[model samples]
Target: MTLTALRRDAPSGKADWLVIFLHGYGSNGADLMTFADYWQGSMPNVAFVAPDGLHEAKDGGFRWIGKRPAGDPKLYDDAVEAAPDLHAFIDGELSRVGLDASRLALVGFSQGTVMALHLGLRREVAPAALLGYSGGLVGADRLSAEVTSKPPVMLVHGEQDQLAPLYGMMMSVKAMSEAGIVCQGVPLAGLGHAVNAEALIYGARFLLSAFAFREKHGV
Candidate 1:
């Protein structure tokens, strides 16, 4: 599966780190790329890439996999089938940009968060960090049996999120912790089903700490 990506190259002309942003359902790469501006100064040597999901939705949005609120087995199977393609796309992006997997991080929102957690856990070479907002672990029951990587994860969700409830976030943290993967979760009070300024700041700090980039560069 060939995925479309929007890239923000490092201003320093050398990227020591790479961040791949995955947007929420019904959104595209352009939506998440906007955050790059805020992160650029703090991570001048890091490149950002946001990729559009594979399937187009009726509301002019995209999805990595079809939704099935009824807990349909087929939909879950489709998501599993789609995972390899998404993983391949990541590999292709890394090769194209001349960056290895070690310097990379995965960030996602909502449905994209599902993809990030699912794929990032199974990757042969784990990413430096995984940051997810308004999302939970899909196929959580099978995570222990399937997980290959144990990278640190930071989960952020709004306490008032009706779309993907706060409980999901709590459950995800618990499951990941039991799986022996380092995990942190923050629930922003009175917030809704979207990323907030606080989430971004926390996410940035998590990424910086995971990669040790701030300390290395004296930032």
Candidate 2:
């Protein structure tokens, strides 16, 4: 299946790094592509891509799964069902861009965070870094057995977020730590179930540091 996506080519005309942004449920790629407007000038050599979700929500928006409450037990199952297509999209897009996993980063929001954690962990090769906002790990219980790689991860959530609580991110950080993966969880005070300026700036700094580290070490 062809996945529709919004792409931003590297400003340098040479793609050295690829960053794929994933949006939350009920949203489309265009919603998250706006990040490039702020981030591209900072990382001119990095390309950006944001894909629309696989399914349609009741309100006529795109989503990774069927419409359901966040705490619903079937949410995980919905993610599992949507995984294959997304996995394929990621792989194909990377190849088409002439980049490898080591030069890749996955940034996700809300439900998009669940996809980043799920697929990024189980991918045959690890990404350069993983950044998630307003989201938590979906299959934490199976991670021990299913995780194939452990790239550095940064999770940012709102302390006041009820949709995806800060506590869930805290627990995910613990799980990732126990698994020997570098994990950073930043909970913003007085923020609700949305991304704030602080979170976006923090994410930019994290990505900058990650890619800089990679360049210095040639990793």
Candidate 3:
């Protein structure tokens, strides 16, 4: 559970909010931490950290599900299997930074998104928000039975993404909504299997609003 990570401290040197970025397969934490740069000016009070996946990928970077062929069902099963380690890192980092679950935001892409949903929903103290990009829900049928909290969620996907298509994102939305979680789905008109400027902006504003809502409602 002790994974290496990349961090960007808040400009104030004291963070009121924390954003944890989870990168896709074969990608490192540093790859997703670039989001911090785009939103730093807007959210001066926020700290960002991206943790490398549990295992290294064959090509380079890291992976959450271990080595599995492209269409393997075991990939999904093991993503759930990988939750405890990621959860450990999350809990440990939140304590190390002096923030509790209410101030934590999870931002995930591709395989990482699947873990975010699985772990966030099962946490005893719900995260402030869960934002997933380019990935669908894993073990959705089990969610109703296992979910302990229903944090606000945002799912963003590219219309032309063949890897993890838009329909998959919508299906995640449907699953979360049916479970009584507030969920939003955004589709980028022509984006491929990648995050763009628009996604960053949307994510930044969404994080800000999530924290604001938590403060206002005190939930």
Candidate 4:
């Protein structure tokens, strides 16, 4: 499936990095594209692309997968099945921008975070980093067998998140650690289920650091 996207070209004209920002459920690509404005200055050579998820929401937005009714295995399976199309969208964006997967990063929020981890882990050539805010891994149990490339991941969640909850971050970190993936979690105190200014700044720094490390080692 071809997903809609908002692209922000790098100011440098020669993009050394690509950021695929995935927005949460009931939101569109434009929702997360604003982050490009805040982050582009720090990494002039980086371009940003925020893609809309597959399904349209009832309230005039979009969703990667249908929401499960609490604990439905079928709902979870649907999410797993939908992941490939999202992965394909990422690949298409990279190819269109003339960028390699190694120089790419995946950033997401809430439901988008679930999609990011689901697809990012299974990528043939993993992204430089996967930075998620207010989100968690969807299929943690199958990560070890399904994941081919293990990219560095940073998860930032609010301590008092009611929507996704802080435990989601913990579960994701634990799963990634068991899979031998480098992962870190940052907790924002007195915060809710939303991205804050501090989270955005932290994400920018993490992306920059991950790319710099990759460059230093020639990966």
lDDT of 3: 0.87
Across 40-140, the per-residue lDDT of candidate 2 in tens digits comes to 88998999999988877778768886555655668778888888998899888899999887888999999989888888887888888899999878767
Clash pairs, candidate 3, are none
What does candidate 4's lDDT look like per residue over 81-158, in tens digits?
A: 887787778788888889888988999888888878877888888789999999888667777888898999999999
| lDDT tens readout by residue for model 3, 1-219 | 689999888898998888999999999999998888889999888889999999989998898876544335676689778988988899988998899888888999998888888888988888899998888687677778888988999988999998887888888899899999999999999998999999988888888899999978865
Off by over 4 Å in 2: none
**Model 4 ranges with Cα > 4 A deviation:** 69-75
Point out the worst 10-residue segment of candidate 4 by lDDT.
67-76
RMSD of 3: 1.6
The whole-model lDDT of each prediction reads 0.85, 0.87, 0.87, 0.85
Q: What TM-score does model 2 achieve against the real structure? A: 0.95
lDDT of 3 at 183: 93
For candidate 1, the TM-score is 0.93
